[model samples]
Target: MTGVEHEPANERYAYSRTALARLALSDELRELADRAAAGVPTTNDMWAQPGEVVGDALDLVHQAQEALVRAVIYERQKHTSWEAIGEQLNMKRQSAHEKYRDAVAEWQLALQEPHYPAPSGAPVRGLRLHEAAYAPTTAGARLDAWVHEHIPAQRETEHPVTGHLPALSTAEEMVQVLDALNHLYGDSRTPPDPKARARVIERKAALLDRIAVEQGRPEAAQQAEEARALAAQLHAEAAQAPD
Candidate 1:
């Protein structure tokens, strides 16, 4: 005959008893009880009627877990003592040490893998909707080449006509570049200043003249002359305005 030994019921209830004692007088416990009474169910089973909610909750949990794992690995990698790590994480030092020992070793080994460069001219992957809409691809051997051709060269640093104008300070250059960029990209809604607008028109007229000379187009030359005449009329009007 085999004899069976029964465990004490008090021993089995020890954890619950300790928990109740610890929480008996706490405001947190009172708040939790109040919330429970208000029919705000805390369990996943209670919210399972809404499939989307369940899925979203699961996604959040997964993201939170990944962040926690990454943080743990980072802390360990940075040579923080287990006791200090436990204090930060609000856990027992021994428990923290045990929980991450295997993960630390695994991550350390993973860090040893040699990093390889991405293939040249590889298509950009995983851009979000807004980013994809704003940044389009251009055919070039490299990103630098693409930028050089597609992005306007920093507004020919010196003005086309009067190399006499003071070199734009960094801030002024930034403002000018940003203004041009906003115009090109449809980011600006306000009308530009009248005086500045006149200057731009004059510069454009000069550029048109140069282009007409290069292309040997009689129509382009006529257009350039018309532009110059318009510019002179605008300048005369501005000069006559009361200061």
Candidate 2:
């Protein structure tokens, strides 16, 4: 909720695919911890609120299910086939597709538009079902905070949760965007839209330019230049793409 409250207007379009996957894993882990805490049996003769406990446990189950859907979306983004997904779920391909088709389609739509019409006909941003739940900036911070509180050992040990993940920064965000674009548009069976790729490359170039100016780093400036050149090349190729 704090993430939603504090999201900047300009920076609230789409989350990188990596963020979605990480958020899904974190959410599932958090719910599992909650369920474990709730399942602790009453050892002493204390006044146990059985109804409240049961309700909390049920809620955790529902939350875990939602997290599973997020995980499925991440898999789908990687071009994983429905048959593979169904095999893992111990069900038929059609059954798995029918179950998750809406969620996957909604995710694809949100990635492109990232906004929906509000009741008053105003376009609302970053409050969609997926964005509100897993905005990259805040989601990463929230997970780090939760880990420190619930899994302090992660901070101390060489655990992937903390060890493998780099600190959240503008450069890190750009890198994630590039990585997601690679998975979506790079060497895939489906023909990617060159214009769309060019547009993203142009944006990356602009961001890198901004970073170079603000950071005054030679490497950043070089990256910015390279990105601009690549973007120009992409635009030229896109011009040659079939209409």
Candidate 3:
């Protein structure tokens, strides 16, 4: 893993230091503002306090979300096959591929985007965030927190569609890209082999078949059939190939 993929924090510890730095900086700034405002007294909101169990837990959730997304990014960069990734993730190959394919593609686009110097003269606008703005107007369940995000009573059901999107490169090219990414991100864990992966898929299908029969779920049985078919194909492919 790149030690400090994000500024002022290291990924080795999942950016805990960086999150703390942000919290401390925010509190200092709030206190300074309180001293200047005269009417506004500085108060330690639960969300802003260091060593608060709930705050740390929330920050950890934020860290985990980012890490999960980045893990998908790193895996894609290595050009790891969806099957292997799925095997490791304990999900169907298609499910894993479908879940992360778009997000990973977007991340690749972002990394390719150009960087620019920060603008001067703006101390900061609003607050530094540790997680996705679940409620834009709220201070996130703090005692003094207020909701800023307005939920309209009615919203449009749909919008105009966009242009056709690009596709991931060929499998060979994707693998090459992943290797390049691995150089930067550093991959140490081994992915599942074809035989092992096939077995996993087969076993899952077997379980699904049993569940389908017992639970009387036709859909589950259909999915089981599909999984079995895929597993058989994978076995055939592995038998013909050299590891």
Candidate 4:
């Protein structure tokens, strides 16, 4: 991976689930608003395709409902109690828990087994279901870019809608991203193939070295040295893995 691929926090190379859920909620709400604002066709024309129009509206409503569920999941992620969520949804706390507890359980289970084996002989070690389904890297970048393009004014304000977006492309975040990637992909100590693993470690080292330089933090520099040492060890291990 090119360390340069991620730069400037606003360009966002990674996203937390909360951000993705918020974006999904906002999108569904916008669609509902647009549909509501679009006035119905005049009498004779309205009768022409009533079923189609009503069906489309029904679909939008369903999507918006699901989006609300996802928004609840985001709140749960932040440790908001069922009581709080139920109050927001205008329901009883027990009702809210019953409605969303399964989804929340599934989310927790996915995190536990973050990656599943790909079909035989796939290039990467495995596919990450949560990453693919909920928070793909591409989704993060595109969502950030969409906001910047469509709602330029958001950049200037601390509006609740746009505020609190993570700066995952920043130097500090890069280190965390690498750490997460390392854990998700395989154990760094005994990866099946070291050639690719070594390269990633090297990139992490380079990023740390850069952060150490730009931020005037010697600790990061020391970490970079440690990372490089690991990379060197991995490179040596590569010879043992058969082609």
RMSD of each: 30.1, 9.0, 19.6, 7.0
Query: Least lDDT summed over 10 consecutive residues: which range in candidate 1?
Result: 131-140
Model 3, 1-243: lDDT tens digits are: 111123322111122222222322333333333433442343645446465646545555665555565555556655668888899889999999898888765544333221222347644332222221112112112212211122132122121111111222333333433443443334357644556457556655765676688778899799889988988988998899886
Q: How many residue pairs clash in all the candidates, one count each?
A: 0, 0, 7, 0
Candidate with the larger TM-score of 2 and 4: 2
lDDT of 1 by residue, 1-243 (tens): 011122122121112211212221122223333444444455755556668565655655665554465566656644668999899889999999898787666543322211222347644332211111112121111233423343477244332212221232333333433444344334366654445445545555655566678767677678768867876776877788778
Better of 3 and 4 by lDDT: 4
Error of 1 at 209 (Å): 56
Structure candidate 4, residue pairs in collision: none
For candidate 3, the 10 contiguous residues with the lowest summed lDDT are 157-166
TM-scores of the models, in the order given: 0.28, 0.57, 0.28, 0.55
RMSD of 1: 30.1
Candidate 4 residues 1-243, lDDT tens each?
Answer: 111212223222245544544554555555565565563545555455748767767877886786687678668866789999999989999999999998877654444334454458655444322332334445445544555655667655444344555433554457545654555466556644566667667767877887888889999999999999998998888877577
lDDT of each: 0.44, 0.65, 0.45, 0.61
Between candidates 1 and 4, the one scoring higher on TM-score is 4
lDDT of 1: 0.44
Q: What is the lDDT of residue 34 in candidate 1?
A: 42
How many clashing pairs does model 2 include?
Answer: 0
Top candidate on lDDT is 2
